[model samples]
Target: MTMINPAGIPHGYNTPIPSEILTADRVETRIGTLEFTDGFPSDDTAAKVFDHLDFLRAVEVFLQCVPAASMEGLRAGLLDIGCDAAHKMVIADRLLDSNPLFLTGNTDTVYALAMLDLHRDGPTVVQIPPGCGPGTVNDAWFRFVTDMGAPGPDRGAGGNYLIVPPEYEGEIPDGYFVSHSPSYTNLLALRGFVVEGKTDVAKAMFEDGVKIYPLSAADARPEMEFSSFSGKEFNTIHANDRTFYNEMADVIRREPIDVIDPETRGLLASIGIRKDRAFAPDEQMCGTLADAAAVGNATARSIVFQTRDKRAYFYEDRKWKTGFVGGDYRWLDGDGRDGRNMDARTMFFYQATLNTPAMALEMVGVGSQYALTERDASGAFLQGSHSYRLTLPSGVPAKDFWSVIVYDPQTRSELQTGQPLPSRSSENNRTELVYNDDGSIDLTFSPEPPSEHRGNWIQTVPSKSWYAILRLYGPLKPWFDKTWKPHDIERI
Candidate 1:
């Protein structure tokens, strides 16, 4: 049998499979199309295939959003659709082979690592071929067989080693101990390692000291004869880990740090990293804190919203007044217009409004619901507004606070104005808000503030549309299971 190169094929299939060699009858039973002979595909198989497609689709979608052509080679082979389970797996394997990390594990690990990077604040070092630049390692990229383990301690969790990128040949300086923080996971340091000519050299700092481990076999492996050494093992921490913040100080102490390239810098800024400073938490890190709030005035709009799932919902009035909602979402549009431009800002507002309550409720035990308010919809006073409101009819679970935030429809960024963007249940804003004597909440939205409830009001910008997101901390069960419905916005 001749070896068939998967990557050599345009979409991983050969034409006719050399029909002359097999009888027609035998050919039908032997190597026919995979789609015809299957029972229902299992969820696991579907998820695996979906992950592969998601990566390809994400890169394609991101390229579509950005104006650069750096990814032309990867894009050329992604046009064909997989026909069956085997075909999908084959195609996925080929794609995975192109990236070193995925060749060793499932895509979830890749996604998890990406999420860690997004949420953690720090510089992430990724291992790559000697000449490859930082652009090649993106949100979808992962590493395998690293000296460190994955970000946290679940599947092969060990230290900051796995999360940070490996040093390139001639990159490691001398006398550096490759230490990392538990929080950001990306900010790393190499102390006490010696920088020799074209190579990093080091002697055991202590009788039992740290040693370097090779991820691939091509590198030199340490033998007992080399040296007996030991040191403190690295630890992986979650976003909420208290040690994370303290570690930030240590990360900043390292000198002559390897800065990420400008392109990656721009990408980082796009994701909410402040361009003004070298070290600061990005947007994802803000979401992890209970009291943390995102920067209110940042002009960086979500340029694109990309997701693996294809299903999404959009509601619009006759005038094209629109609202959209979806999960695992990514930005596709940036212009904010309703047509085909794929507005990331609009989608971000809709998604935040839709998911925040659900997420908050999950943290508590409540169920909540959301709906777009129509011009003449009628219900209790809580149900009359054009703005969105989530209520913990049973009450919130937090010992301290909870609130709702509003966003501009076009930019998906927080609407900046004199009126407060979030309405909290705390005494500071509660007495000024419209609420039932029974303690249930109502959020008001309009061009002008309501006559009675001024504090709980969200102002709409002129010629601009808006969407509201409700965040309920320590929620009740009714909010999560969808048993409780959210009040709508009424344009008075």
Candidate 2:
């Protein structure tokens, strides 16, 4: 709606036009030169900016859809391992080791994993017995759907859980904990704690008690099948290549159109990743998306490995940090006073899986807490070739127990060393750890075994980079009040 004065005014308008509103003849940007004539962009300028816009949008999509791709990768990996149905699942009967390329999976607990397809099964039912540890169900986007076991409504006295899809209008039967998920594909990951350094009880409990079946088949449910994935070379880590976009496309095609918001859907569409159509981009666009993936992967790596956010640090003086920054499971910045923290979201999903309020909320002695450190004292990254020592002071504030697991920075998985499990838990390594007269425990990290602390030594590969995560199960008040803190790792 242009209202041009038929008779030109003194300065082409009734008032002088501000320079800010007018376009110059030429403008330079990081993308390239943008040329315009009388406020109209040249064809080359329009094409350049449009291409750059698509590239930027593609990068955002990669960052935003990382969770989706990760979940899809889990599903695909499970399917490859013969866990193709809801009744079939994989369990770490012995415990997870370095063989599996999982995202920061701890070696302390027995894990059970399953992929549920509500679209295929209609309504799914999960039944577990008493003594089942913490478990969670995440949507295709890795959003928290519900918790089971300790943090669940049953409070470790496990019962039946009915998970239905978003479009489900079926009757809610009594005596079941119902959860509605917006996506068809959901990941059900369960963990069972090791008691007295043994995984036999937890493994047997899952094998004997856990049952999953479609609710419609309640009268004649299929038999539950469990496969042991301990020491297996399984891959659940998402692709960092251009195939990451394909993983997102698969999830989009599998789930309903309304699974994601319109803004996210439009962003994917901008990169030709719409569910209604094929995700086949032209040759030039393919190369652009590949480059975008490289950039996105590098950004995610930086966010996880070298975060600039101070809130991630657990202590002002130490390198120990928390994975759930801002203490919000939703990844909201300042509790949503600012919108979603995009980098925070990437930081978590890039290196770890699972999203539950139990990991964020202040449950003190009830929930678990984690402190990760990639660097040692003197603000130096932990080198595999160098020797270091870490000391946990007296009165370690864990009600149940604590564990420290070493992980490779590149894979974000358990470090591949001579030891089967690249970790030492209080329960698992009680007989091995040497305690000082003052009741403090000192651990050694080096390529060679230490003479004085041979039992406390964890093998590290030379020329590699690694990190460590100190997990406190049932952390007590001292942990929250900052009265207790793990000492920084010092070079030895």
Which portions of model 2 miss their true places by more than 4 Å?
1-14
Angstrom error of the Cα, residue 176, model 2: value is 0.4
Compute each candidate's TM-score over C-alphas.
Answer: 0.33, 0.96
Predicted model with the maximum lDDT: 2
lDDT of each: 0.29, 0.89
Clashes of 1: 49
For candidate 1, write residues 1-492 as lDDT tens digits. 233455433223565355344222111223232221123444654554544443333233232222111111111112122111111111121111112211011110011111223122133332211111011122211111122221112112222233333333334333222433222222111112112211112222211232223333114533212211111111121111222222322222321132334554444344333334454544444333222211111111222122222233222221112223332223223332433334433333322211122221133432222222222233222221244334434354333244554454333334444443323334335456566677776666556666766766656555554444444433455544545544344334
Q: Give the runs in model 1 whose Cα sits over 4 Å from its true position.
A: 1-163, 166-400, 420-428
Best by TM-score: 2
